[model samples]
Target: MSAVLQLLVLVVLAPYLVGLMRQVRALMEGRAGAGIGQPWRDLRKLFRKEPISPDGSSWVFVAAPAVLAATTLVIAAVAPFAATVSPLDGVADLFAVVALLLLGTVALALAGLDTGTAFGGMGASREITVAALAEPTILLAGFALSARVGSTNLAAIVERGNHSPGDLLSPATLLAAVALAVVVIAEAGRLPVDNPSTHLELTMIHEAMVLEYSGRDLALVEFASALRLTVLLGLWVNLFVPWGIATSEAPLALLGGAAVFVVKVAVVGAVLAAGEVFMAKLRLFRVPELLAGSFLFGVLAVSSSFFLA
Candidate 1:
């Protein structure tokens, strides 16, 4: 109905999307996973539990969750759920969205370092390194889409992509999509990049950073991670294949738009789940090489956009 309400829907729906992904992954592996609302239950249980801070932890430890949640909620507010309209539309741009996402990332990384644990420091170092390398590709790929539309606003990108199914098939758009997809895997801690479910210290990039946080704080961080995944996937949908995104405010139009959006997200989630199940995690040292290839692809995409245009 309203932008505020739609924003709330995105927040609430993000967790379910995570659950659905888990369920799909489970089904693919022939294991029955927890129910689709498990994330909500996990959050509720965590909130009721008492937090346990490490002996050396300080205010930075306590503030990390608040900052992470606030940053994610702000990013969600600016992200268009149905179409071009967002709660923070006037202040939102594709590049600004990228920055906000990175801000949350930096805050978490700093908090990880503040804990002074070996794993925390190591994770933070790896996370920032991956981030530093991934961010340029993210911006350049987004710019490729924006370059075609002549605006950096995310909503505009979606609006234009929706009208042109062939938009993504363009050499620039395809190359950018491939690059952004790699960045998405890295940014979201998915398999073949950084495995979110890993317990091994040497392999973990995200979990190691949060190993010191417990109870509510850990829950917030995990939830934010899930939200980050949703944001990245939504961006992929909007910028690459925005077929069902609606520009109309009418009841039926919005309803149809919502239906299409759900189906599109589900399809993407299932595809990702399957990919994860079939793919092995990459060696930690080799991660940069993969990301570097993505950056090169993105560069080619932008070049194609300019020369081919």
Candidate 2:
């Protein structure tokens, strides 16, 4: 039941979260931007239109949106949302979650390359390059957390954090969180990595990959992007900082946990949006260095765990 509710919350709230982040960015810039419901309106508009496929593209091009949305939805469904022991937690370990996320990335990359456009190929190449560099950091960070709990299970990690909040303040834990904050910025198409709203071909990464998608396909891709961000952010918060998360199945606990989850994510989104306003997007060649630095942080996190323990 908790898992079911989690899934519902994921689908229903992802667009609004995107809107909220955009609104935050706008307010920070002293502009009266669109409402927090703007993304929902955009989604509705996209769904009402038709999707057009590029000529010479294969099934991968046609099905990429579905692939992206399905995999992300699965990740969100299995994530330990409000409760540590979600209905799907039995099958969701950290490795499984990471692999699923990579799967979505790979599918989109394949689709981007499948289109055979200069922009698509460029986006795919750049996206894959970042993913390759960022993969080690993500795995090492997960391992850092899992090692302390003696299990790679996300629920175990969360349960451990909830029971021992001191762990959240440890050197290893903070380093992993730092590593993941970098990872999410890259994975979720945020600035200083890739701008989520860029249209210039040279500066576009995630947006370029979806350049050929239109209408319903576009909507699915957008939703998948938003859901991926939400899920990744949720995991980051719940794993490294599990204070307000529900560790029990009690009703009051679940409700409180849900409220806390929203508050945490909103605060995170605000900080990220505000930071993007001040941070310039890194040069394409410099991206490798940033990801390398993040990977180094992950290594230090692992080393710290071993030495500190």
Candidate 3:
């Protein structure tokens, strides 16, 4: 029941989260932004339009959006968001969760290549490169968190943190938080890594792959992207700041937990958007350096868990 609530919450709140971020950025830039309902309106319009496919595209192109959306849904369902306990806890291993994320990424990359467009190929190559670097840091950071719990299950880690508040302030936890935060920014294609709002061919990492998608296809892709950002932020919140999460399965507790989860994700998303306003995307070649630095933090986090703990 908690898991179902989480899935529904993410689906409904993801677009609003994106809108909140955009509103924050626009406010920071001294402009009156579109209201927070704009993303929902856009998705509604897209769904009503006819979808078009590129002439040479195959099944891969037709399926990638669904595959990506499916993976995001799975993760959102199993992950400990509003509640620490979930019916699918057994499958919510950190490694499995990360693998599911990569599966979606790979599916989209394959679709990009399937398009046979130069921009598609270029974007796929860049996306894969970023994923290769980002995914490992996510694993290492997860490992750092799991060391104290002795289980790779994400629920176990969050449950342990909720029970041991001091653990959140430990050297290992702090380091892993920073590392995972960087990976989240990179994985979400935010500023200083890749610009989510840009279409400049030289800087397009995610947008290029879906250049041929229109109508319903584009809606699914966009929704999946927004959901990815929300899920990642929600996971970070529950992992590091598990205070408001329900440890029990009571109805009232679940409701409060869901409300708190929404607030925390919205705050984090707004902060990220505001930060992006003052930053510029890194040069393509320089992206590896930033990722490498995060990787180093992951390594240090692992070491800290063993030594500092």
Candidate 4:
């Protein structure tokens, strides 16, 4: 398959995965749930509705989701989906990927603050505070894997892992993966960090920031958030466990690779949803402590990588 086609698949399927996870969560909670296609319907409904922005808000509120979605789509295009292949592989550096991802997060947080609502300001402040610490953990943990593999490019790391899946069990790899998993939960606004389902003023972090967005603006932001979650989960699966990802251009191999990719992502999403189901939301103040533990784990993982290498 062509890289362009693969990118299109990612762009289209990312939201479906988020919706599926929500469906799974709803089932687990014993509620009749919206199907996986519900998000698409929600997006359509949102786009047809009239937008209502805050009077205090600037263009930032309108522009944030476009910037975020564009950046995230580009980042997804560059990340290795099937072995060493990437749509933007020629320029794929893991550090640059991490930076691009963070850029979107920072932009959205700034947009939240630009609204000048109390919830917006509070959300932005807390978001950035958590982000300031989480970003380094992401870089360092991924860097540890890159250091061991001899390339900071995600494609190269996956190439190496595909040839040696056992390496995923290494102390450094395990530590990095575990730390990255925790960071993913925090980064994606899952439970034990932030809750997406909550409307309570005091406990919400991500939802609080977008209280001012409505219609298409809100839809875009929510869709972008779900896409970001899918992207991060894809990165985790691609980097740590890449056994069946395509390394050859053969059609059969590519088909197999794509199947493996879907299975891996589905299992990861299910585990994440289950974790959310079993856990309660953390307090606002305790969020910092939870993220701090992830940071410490990431630091240890990085240190172990250098020491072992």
* lDDT by candidate, in order shown: 0.83, 0.88, 0.94, 0.82
Candidate 3: Cα lDDT at 17: 95
For the record, the alpha-carbon RMSD of candidate 4 to the native fold, in angstroms, is 1.6
By TM-score, how accurate is candidate 4? 0.95
Output the lDDT of residue 178, model 4.
84
- Give residue 45's error in model 3 in angstroms: 0.4
Model 3: per-residue lDDT, tens digit, 17-43? 999999999999999999898999999
Question: What tens digits encode model 4's per-residue C-alpha lDDT throughout 1-309?
Answer: 535544665667777888888888999999889898898888989989888988877888889888888888887667777546644676778778878878888888988899888898888888888788788889888878887678788888888888887777878888888889888888888888888888888888888888988998888887788878888888899888887888876777766776787788878998888778899988878888877887788888888888886
lDDT tens string, model 2, 246-300? Answer: 8777888877888888888878887888888999989999999999999988998
- Give the alpha carbon lDDT tens digit for every residue of 1-309 in model 1: 635555666677778888998998899989999978999999888888778888888898888877877877777767665656544676668778878878888998988999989999999999998999899999989888888889888887888887777877899999999999999989998989887767897799989889988888888887888777887887787778787776867767666766676677778977998889999989988999999999999999989989997
Clashing residue pairs in candidate 4 are: none
Model 3 regions lying over 4 Å from their true place: none
Against the hidden reference, what TM-scores do the models get? Answer: 0.95, 0.98, 0.99, 0.95
Best by TM-score: 3
lDDT of 3 at 88: 93
Candidate number achieving the greatest lDDT relative to the actual structure: 3
Model 4 misplaced stretches (Cα beyond 4 Å): none
Clashing pairs counted in every model: 0, 0, 0, 0
Kindly indicate the candidate among 1 and 3 with the higher lDDT: 3
